[model samples]
Target: MNAPAYENGRLALMLNEPRLPTIGRFWPEFAERSDKEGWQASRLLGALLEHELAERAKRRIERHRTESHLDPTKTLATFDFGMVPMVSKAHVTALATGESWLEKGATILLFGPLRAGKSHLGSAIGHALIDAGYRVLFTRTSELVQKLQAARQSLQLPSALAKLDRFDLIILDDLSYARKDQAETSVLFELIAERYERKSLLITANQPFSGWNDVFPDPGMTVAAIDGLVHHSTIFELYVESYRRRKASDKQSAPATITMEARQL
Candidate 1:
């Protein structure tokens, strides 16, 4: 075994670089073949780095998909369609397929019962935009209003609104889910008035405009809210059942989703 001193010399040359994990894993073999495969190590190292970079990009895209649309807090897999509006599909297809038409600030709305697919549809549209590499944002109606107020309280409301405008499509989910105080209602109207005819908007609400008085409190504010929201909006009224309860009834861990139109008018 001690007869070949040349073998040890060849091993030393191949083992020269110990930094690369890929190379270190095969160090012994590489060292043995140093003379015949001397240039191969450098080429192999380059290839390894390229693969790693590509994988990293893939992970980043996936994270964006989840964060921007799916909402890391919600699960799309749990969306149930058993209670989706019958006519919801047509409007959704128009929005999803005709995203190009959104440049002029087309609007979409979802008015439905609790446990219906309002937020789901809104998020789904947001997800579609994200898939197309377009900018999108989703926020609960109450939460976004609170954020705007918080920004104003901190003297940064304008800065916050500027970022809102950056997104091509913004989904305001669960707008009337909770009763709004007078101040919150006024802030909500102001935000709507600003976004009106400026960008594509998706709003989901359980209460119809006729019930607006309860939330807006002021008759004038109610008119303002409705005018801004409906002037350039596609309104969807979902009279469907509770998709969530449907799943509960079946005792199926998996949910079945339905996408249908609520009504045109």
Candidate 2:
């Protein structure tokens, strides 16, 4: 029945209390509505709290998506599951929910040749995971390797990895594109080893596990990295024709491509 004094409310705002802004904005309307409709105080408070929580959730989802570095255009809605028959829509949907593998710190490997929708699928799942309130980071394998190498040079590798540890999931796109340099591969292995069983990884690669030898300098390290990755992992082998090539072919087959000369005639 009692309300905080104006000075006390100002102090709460200065102290940055949660939901105070929402309460301040809605309390008068809520009171008026309750009085007019004979609503209970408990019901009004519950509605206000629910609204505050929903706002907080929306802000958190926005922050996660911005920090994730995922491609905005690539999302589950845009991904054509029928076009990539090699990939299972059910399996992708399950993973996108970030329930089983992501929770258990397992890996999801998308293996296929170029333009097989690997990057799109991985990024779409990253977006889904972001919506599901999971922190995610999407980076190209080469860019990540370069960052690690730079961190090693600066003697800040530990700090870098520690910062990376904050993310629940990391989407490494195009894993096989990174050059097979010893320094780069070493730090890449360190990242894999550090996150082993601690965080989840979603990788899109153009090469299979056996072909990873071309990406690593030493066979032993390659095996170790592969072991750590696949020990608790789900592999999706996408062996369809290149999506880009198919699109090009469709464009070529379209009837709208008549020459300007023909139109003029």
Candidate 3:
């Protein structure tokens, strides 16, 4: 049946219902379906509200992801577990889901040499957490320190740290890339202290704990930083050959790479 038309062609107003106009405009199809299905008024309202809430939640997640600054290309689906034989697929899978450790504000430390896929693993986990509706931020350690240093100069360091606190997990990529000077390392320590036991952190480094002194000039500071990070952390030492090197080796072994002079015969 057609709705009775009023002077403005909006019979919803005749019921003196303000919410009905919004409902009709936003969910016209659902309104028509409810009418056709002869649904109970209370039930229809509940269903419409639930749908609106779900859509709102989806929008919020998308917005959070965009503000997270995570790399779009890195995801759990794209990470190759086969390439990294030392890593346990079951264990990484559990962590990637971001369910278990996120609640406890635990840290994930990825330590390995260059080209060992440490950054890739950290970004993958950060991406997964974003997909799971958790806020995440990815930034190079040196870059983050520079930003913090600037914030300190401008007398906004506390607010800068506060802004970072909004994220549930912060992926600090290439922690070893930062210089081990007093000016740089102090801000880094401040960040760790602020986030200690409060928010989760995922750090990727080409150096192990023993080599952290190379990243923190003071030995005492190095010990303190390592102590804070490892207290409730899941550490992964990816002791494997470089994936890029292995791929290059495989290409060299392939028949397709035969010399042109040999083919000329």
- lDDT scores for all predictions? 0.69, 0.86, 0.82
Candidate 1: lDDT over CA atoms?
A: 0.69
Candidate topping TM-score: 2
Prediction 1 TM-score vs. true: 0.66
Pairs that collide, model 1: 81-257, 81-258, 85-260, 86-260, 86-261, 87-260, 87-261, 88-260, 88-261
lDDT of 3 by residue, 101-145 (tens): 988888999988898888778888877777688899889999999
> Which segments of model 2 are wrong by more than 4 Å?
1-19, 247-265
User: Which 10 successive residues of model 2 have the least lDDT summed?
Assistant: 11-20
TM-score of 3: 0.83
Off by over 4 Å in 1: 1-63, 69-85, 88-90, 251-265
For residues 117-216, what per-residue lDDT tens digits would candidate 2 score against the true structure? 8888889999999898899999999999999899999999999999998899998999898765888889999999999988999898998888898889
Residue pairs of candidate 2 with colliding backbone atoms? none
Ranking 1 against 2 by TM-score, winner: 2
Better of 1 and 3 by lDDT: 3
Point to the candidate with the largest lDDT. Answer: 2
